[model samples]
Target: MTTQYAKPLPRVHDLNRAFFLGALDGRLVLQHCDACGHVWFPSAQSCPKCLSQEITWKPVSGRGRVWSWVVMHQRYIPAFADDLPYAVAFVELEEGPFMMTSIVGAEPEDLVCDMPVEVAFDQVTDEVALPKFRPVTGEAS
Candidate 1:
């Protein structure tokens, strides 16, 4: 039985294919050290702490708050021309990790520190779909 899902993202940065596939499955995957409990994003080969090679993948809640942000008046890529005036933000996940992505579903004037945000996925191309953040319902602040 197949459920509708995101297509696979293109290979980049020599990272593990499983990591990308996990995101396509609508679950956030990150590496955690079995020895020291250290977690790594972008899926490293092993844990950065304690030099442990015993790392495993785990799903995390995609909830976070807006830690910082910037309003981009110009598109660095032509593909993003239509998305001009977007807010690029760094969200510090409640799980204790920081992710850099665009903030959606809210106006620039409404974005502020510690604003409640939730993850939303967007298929930017046939190969890659990104996880972005949007303001949580009724939490406009």
Candidate 2:
């Protein structure tokens, strides 16, 4: 098997450590506000809705729909040069948060807005697993 090198790894700090750690065990987590029951991504110190500092890391169903997508024909970063013509997408999670991720397991031309998709984890390194999306098959959207 050929080993692939990951382009970049997220810096784990106290604020967003839970997110990266959750990926270690194949779980997709988001920041949830205990005060207003609001959940969001790209973790923050307080709830965006209620401005509550009581945030919790909660697991979410790894299912969503493709909100939008773009095909990268040119390599903007040297590390991504080998993987040209890939699709990067915004997936609207079932819990109401949109996550930026790469859509895999299907051709770029096959991706459509509002397509049902589910999360798939790719272990780029021993310490990190990136959550990606793939089209749902045999299931009604």
Candidate 3:
């Protein structure tokens, strides 16, 4: 059997530690500004809108639409060479945050703008779980 190389995992840091930890527990969270009521992603120390330091992690509905997507046909990284032609999408969550994530459980040709999706977790390692998106079924978009 051939050894399968694992894809790169995100480095957990003080600024984004909560995000990775939240994924481990199956919760999708984003930083929310208490002052301006703004929500953002990729975890920051301050709110981009009001620039307030009073930021807190809040759970979102995990429902989003495919704002945009790209089919990566090139193998830029060796680890992901085997998974070529995958869809990397910009998902706009219902809470007003756009997250960069991969869309799984669907063909590349099937993706479209404004397509409804929901969060799904993939345990890449024992301590890390990456949040991905998939088509929502049996629910209104």
Candidate 4:
């Protein structure tokens, strides 16, 4: 049989030292272009549209809607054994940035497109905390 539980790749960036430090502190930092009012994720130095170096970092409301999702039934690594079946989804943040993150605090059977979600943090490593999502509390009808 093929290796259904191979190890996942190590993170490319030191999230804890860089991004997670701010996120853990309850600050959501995204790159904002002063020229076009556009925001960039993964923290780009320049605007993707205008390529302007004139950028600023700002905090955003960590609320979004589930734009899309997929459930992985097969395990890719031993570390993921317990989480054999999990939902990976694209969360469209209110600030106009779409991020790929795991959907938590809810079951896959209940997940749907356009379901409101709010941000929660997961500390994978000492310095690497990820921004995950949960169902928005007191969601409007």
Q: Candidate 1 — worst ten consecutive residues by lDDT sum?
A: 1-10
Q: Local error of candidate 4 at 45, Å? A: 2.4
Can you write out model 2's per-residue Cα lDDT over 1-141, one digit (the tens) per residue?
245665976777889878878987899999999999999988999999999999889999999999998899998888888888899899999999999999988899998888999988987777677899999998765
Best to worst by TM-score, what's the order?
2, 3, 4, 1
Top-TM-score structure, candidate number: 2
State each model's CA lDDT, in order. Answer: 0.77, 0.89, 0.89, 0.78
Backbone clash total for model 2 is 0
How many clashing residue pairs appear in each of the predictions shown? Answer: 0, 0, 0, 1
**Structure candidate 4, residue pairs in collision:** 16-127
**lDDT measured at residue 88 in model 3 versus the true structure, 0 to 100:** 93
Model 3 Cα displacement at 37 (Å)? 0.7
lDDT of 4 by residue, 1-141 (tens): 233333353364532234556676766677789998888677666798799988877788988999999998997766877886899999999989999998889998889888999888865555455688999868861
Encode model 3's per-residue lDDT on 93-116: one tens digit a residue. Answer: 999999999999889898988889
Q: In candidate 1, what are the lDDT values of residues 17-49, reduced to their tens digit?
A: 655566667777778889998876657777776
Error of 2 at 72 (Å): 0.6
